[model samples]
Target: MPKKLPEVILYTDGACRGNPGPGGWGALLIWNGKEKEIAGGNPQTTNNRMEMKAIIEGLKTLKRPCHVKIHSDSALIVNTFTKGWIDNWIKRGWKKSDKKPVENRDLWEEMLRAAQPHKLSWFKVKGHSDDELNNRVDALAVAESKKF
Candidate 1:
């Protein structure tokens, strides 16, 4: 019989004061009723990079392979992962359909690699809603961004 895997839930958010200015990432990781918060920032970065970083950090926290549910408010992040856009990029050698260079290919590729060891489901949640965890992550991201 297969070993029982831990059920993990993660809520992530990213923020940027300006489009290409101060940026931060936040995540809330929950397992077996316990929760852990993760956050970071960069002085010069984009919101999308922060979003990808949040997922990358959250996944890296896992000790071993397990089932993971990732929640995000960014449609670009959720759709790109769930709709297989990343795989398409990989197949096309990290180029988009238009054959243009993929922006943030580094972070996206790192996120993809970090995600490979687990069973992941990407879910989209409305931002600034009543979701407590999501709101918490938003706050964390904002706070981190302010530090820059």
Candidate 2:
């Protein structure tokens, strides 16, 4: 019988004072009863970019392919993957249904590459909610944004 792989749970958040201003991202990764926290910021960027960056950085932490469950409050990120927008985007040469180029193709491509090694499930959580992990990452992201 094949060995069972352990599941990794991740919670991520992002914040920006303005749509195109100082932005930050935070992520919490849990695996095998252990937890890791990661965060960073960009001097000038968008909230959506920060959100995707959090997921990208979180996935980069794994040493090997594993079952990953990613939880985020951003509907953009969740829906893009969960609603099959990503697959169609690739098929349509990175253009949206409106025949416009995807706004964050670079980040999306990076995310796809980072995610390729694992079996992933995306979950959308309510932002500013009572979920402890979600709140923690949100706070972390907000704090990071304040640094610059």
**Tens digit per residue, CA lDDT, model 2, 111-131:** 999998899999999999799
Q: Kindly report the root-mean-square deviation of model 1 from the true structure over all alpha carbons.
A: 1.0
TM-score of each: 0.96, 0.97
Model 2, residue 21: what's the lDDT?
Answer: 97
lDDT of each: 0.92, 0.95
Instruction: Tell how far residue 33 is off in model 1, in angstroms.
Output: 0.8
Q: Against the correct fold, how does model 1 do in TM-score?
A: 0.96
Alpha carbon lDDT of residue 119, candidate 1?
A: 91
Which 10-residue span in candidate 1 carries the lowest summed lDDT?
2-11
